[model samples]
Target: MKNWNQQEVEILKSKGGVIALANPYDNLVTTGVEPWPPAEVVQKLYQSRQTRAFSEEEKEKLQKFNGYYSDFQSIHSEDAITWSVFGTIARAQIEKRNKFISELFQTLDLESEAVESSEIYLWRRIPHPDNLVPSGPEIDFGILTNDTLVLGEAKWKSSLGAAQGKNKDKNQIQLRVEFLQKYAPKLYPGVHNFVVLSVGLNNDVTENYTGKTVKCISTTWGAICCLQSHPHHDELQRYLAWKIKNTKNG
Candidate 1:
């Protein structure tokens, strides 16, 4: 249902060919699915907050408010164009909270009871190590339990490295771990890392690059809608392949 692009082709090759993804639905047959919430509820919670097109007035507001875009008119950036992707990430947390956060943990084989008891958090601001005002990388979403923690970063069409950037000690994931260690030492050493992205990346790349420090999962509009929408294995495989082939960062 989707057309292939260069990035998708490359990602497929990187992941040992497209054969496995070719029929991803096969794996979905056994995946358990909870019924989705009603349409109105979903609309209220997850609807995109972006205007269909960026109008002159909206551009002026962004230029005035978002410092990052102050010079947007003078200098063009593809990244800037996609900045609103964060809206998708926020909506995902608000609407598909359970499916994206809790269900994903279950899919990853995290402890059932712990995941069931997990709470989702959106870290828009990070406090300094000294417990000062928020002053660090902004994390997207997190799932926390008494002993287990899952840190997540969301992106629409960017790789984890691109989205996270290169920060030595202030990395978002590192910040989260350090925060828990400093405040709630009990949750230390119980960290599980995740990246929710809609781009041309595979688990193999994620595991190899991070040395398995984090688990990478795909999302739609920054939500884990692939497996959640597929009640049958066949549909899962098809939709997954489609998503992988379509979502290119550039």
Candidate 2:
């Protein structure tokens, strides 16, 4: 495996950008926030994880500078993209936030009813209904309202992961849907929405995951970047635009 720091440095170079340092802690090159978002906002998002226990993998990842939670230098990181986009939304003024959410729902063909009141949580671990795994899928982010839950899986240069160990037949989406159907309601008590947010996706995902009980909607990071206009969005938009361009050219 490539050193995570080197991977990010290469991605930045590929975009015709340069970095003074290759380290995540020093570079803070993310989807493009400099030195990260406001300390309070980042702290609140981090604190949300305290609501539940983390798996050993999650705990270890949290400790590493290049791991998802601490990573801000990687342009190819899904967590970096997720935090930059939604973290900005989390701190936006209510009107602008709601407007952005409304436009996002319309773009994804989802109902707009919950846009105004939803709460956003990042990297939340939902327990498996079957107890077959040590921990269930750690959702990239979740938008929750009184009657609706939107679980998002984000990608930049990667594809959705496959099931490991004993559950080889199911893909990550299937596992997430299983949680959405079997366990989500007991915790959130709402209509479920499973969204695959990516630059582009394989057809197999849509063909295999969409069903009556759970709807798997596919949308791109570029589409999301287009949904809002805010000063805070400038860096993230520029970063995602480069990613989308590169993804298409290849």
Candidate 3:
């Protein structure tokens, strides 16, 4: 029997937990898949049905058929681990920026609301999107909505190294367009934007990104921005405005 003690619990877990084993569907990891481009990830999954850890019978099933797909496995998938690390750190930085920006703006007593609703996911690791959803490979960060879809990639570094491995050739960033084309077609139903934020620049890389209708942008916080949890907004004009003491200084 499939352990009726936790049948209900296992059933619920079984619904989707399989990916956790095969793909580690860690949603919030919530950031980069590899030093290389996430689009490079390509493989077929192989396994017998039934979750709750591989059982003897399930192992037998895998060996019984033993077809090409049977042995199919991801020996080297995209660095889902790195992506997860990047996402978690980057989102935290975003929150920090939001706070700093909000605190700075609040002092002026401005009347504007910044929505704090956005999800970051460790997306690129999946062989395919969860439950065969119509999502795409704009991984690292690809969130979609009614009007606009934001495809974000977060790059991180310690800045302690003499050299860093960034897509200096602009290869991965360039492939992002293709990543969109292949992974999540639905996100591109209409308009979209591409964002690449790096902690530091690679040793010999140039910043050359392209797309016809895509709006591509980078951050002002320099490449070392990763080391700082919170970043000052790069608008020197705005920073200068804040520099002069306001009538109210807390």
Best candidate according to TM-score? 2
lDDT for 147 (candidate 2)? 53
* Candidate 3's TM-score: 0.32
Give a tens-digit lDDT track for model 2, residues 1-250.
Answer: 1222334332223222322123443323243334555563354334223212345544454435433432344334456566667766766667766677667677767764656476666777777645746587776777665555677777655666776324477666777777767766566655555443333333232334556656777676656666655435566566565544443323
Over 1-250, each residue of candidate 1 has an lDDT whose tens digit, in order, gives 2222222321121121212121211112122322433222222222123322345444344333222222212111112112222222223433444444456656655543433334555444555544545565555555565445555555433344433323343444444445544554433455444332222233321322232433344434323334452233243344345544443334
Which candidate has the top score in lDDT?
Answer: 2
lDDT of residue 243 for candidate 1? 46
The residue pairs that clash in candidate 2, if any, are none
Query: Would you estimate the TM-scores of all the predictions?
Result: 0.40, 0.65, 0.32
Question: What's model 1's TM-score?
Answer: 0.40
lDDT score, candidate 2, position 157: 56
Shift of residue 98 alpha carbon in model 2, Å = 2.3
Writing each residue's lDDT as its tens digit, candidate 3 over 1-250 gives: 0211112111111222222222223111222223432332222233424333445444333343333112122111223323333333334555663454344224323333562533444444322222333442335545433333445454322222222113233344454544444454464464343333322223322155555544445442232222333332232223222212111222
